[model samples]
Target: MSMIKKRRMIEIQQLQDDSEKQNVTRFILEALPQWFGILEAREEYITESVNKMFFCAYDQDRPIGFLYLKETGKDTIELFVMGVLQEFHRKGIGRALFYRAKRAAREKGYSFIQVKTVKMGIYEEYDRTNQFYQSLGFKEFQVFPMLWGESNPCQIYVMTL
Candidate 1:
């Protein structure tokens, strides 16, 4: 069988219930400490996701990845937080969630979808993250050297919808 056909199926769906969203966010983030090791930030993401647009990628009933979108401007939506279990990395689950995010933004009439991550070159794990966002057509918008702390300079990327 081809590699694609050999892989298990994954489904992406928007989560509506507040409790489910928080639970899934916590579950996925806990499995990805390399990206979400900061307890305060992780907790904030779990809590705030209830109000933002949220999507979860599941293998059967188990959540393997998730993405959250928050309206940052009248015409801009930010990819507020996202995580995929390490085992599922580069397996198209993140890309699938991203396409869903782009479709949601375009359907909502947003002009831009933005994402922020630790600047590339500062960390190995985040460098792959930067690459992933760039590969998905997001371009560098700006940088906030102290936003996440001097050790983790924040790089912002935006994709026009």
Candidate 2:
């Protein structure tokens, strides 16, 4: 059985090769400036993803979305970063990538999954991001008032596997 899934001409695949992960991570993040506008932060994500679990969603041969998972603890994993092309939003690519990552985490014996984002209401872009995570059953766990900065407070969301 393959982890690859295809629907509506979009396909999702888990990438194990480091270079491919870096390539896809850079490509997808570059395509999503609204979510990954900070050059420093985006570069950090791309570099870190090379050593994390990576999954990519592609339309034909064009990578459109990606998710990276990092182990946060013996029993916990975090969705370090994720993004889908703006044109592909609400079309299930993000959801598919998430479920794939979740399944992989459970198989690896992870008991909890978490993600962090800019706290909602501070920005419209992040408000949608907050809602997306909530729609996937992630519950708000905490808020770090100045984790990112005074303006971009960080909100953590978690789910039990």
Candidate 3:
């Protein structure tokens, strides 16, 4: 007899309510220390304005990853946060969320999608993050020193489609 194995399914959906907001914020806070040198309590204000939020990579209905995107202007979108639960990292969930964000941007008629990352600090993952964006066709467009604060230098990248 042959046995069949089922593959895990992932679903991406916009966060639609207060309950989802809490879940998404919690996920970001949990992932922030590893990616951001310092996590600020005030960042929740930005999260609350997430124009587009994606919940991705679920295992039997349990969320394993999420992405938060915000609009910068009429024709611009910014990737605010994208992260996967620790157990689900390196499984392509991040990339999937990225593509979804791009598609959303395109649908909204955004000419450019921008992402900002710290240029230096304990956040060495910024390099990898920048490379990942470049791999997805985004290019370095600008660099702002102390953009987020007195100590954080930000590198801005833009993808034109």
Range of the 10 consecutive residues with the lowest summed lDDT in candidate 1: 1-10
Q: After superposition, how far is residue 79 of candidate 3 from its true place, in Å?
A: 0.9
The TM-scores of all predictions, comma-separated, are 0.95, 0.94, 0.80
How would you encode candidate 2's per-residue C-alpha lDDT over 29-143 as one tens digit per residue? 8988888889999999988987788899988899999999999999999999998888999989999999999999999999999999999999999999999999999999999
lDDT of 3 by residue, 17-125 (tens): 7567566666555665666335464266335644455445566767777776778898888887666776776678788878877887788788988888776343657
lDDT of 3 at 131: 71
Candidate No. with top TM-score: 1
As a TM-score, model 3 comes out at 0.80
The 10 consecutive residues of candidate 3 with the worst lDDT sum are 41-50
What value does the lDDT take at residue 38 in candidate 1?
87
| Superposed model 1: Cα runs more than 4 Å off | 1-6
- Tell me each candidate's RMSD, in Å, in order: 2.1, 5.3, 2.9
How accurate locally is residue 9 in candidate 2, as Cα lDDT from 0 to 100?
A: 83
How many residue pairs clash in each candidate at the backbone level?
A: 0, 0, 0
Residue 140 in model 1: lDDT? 97
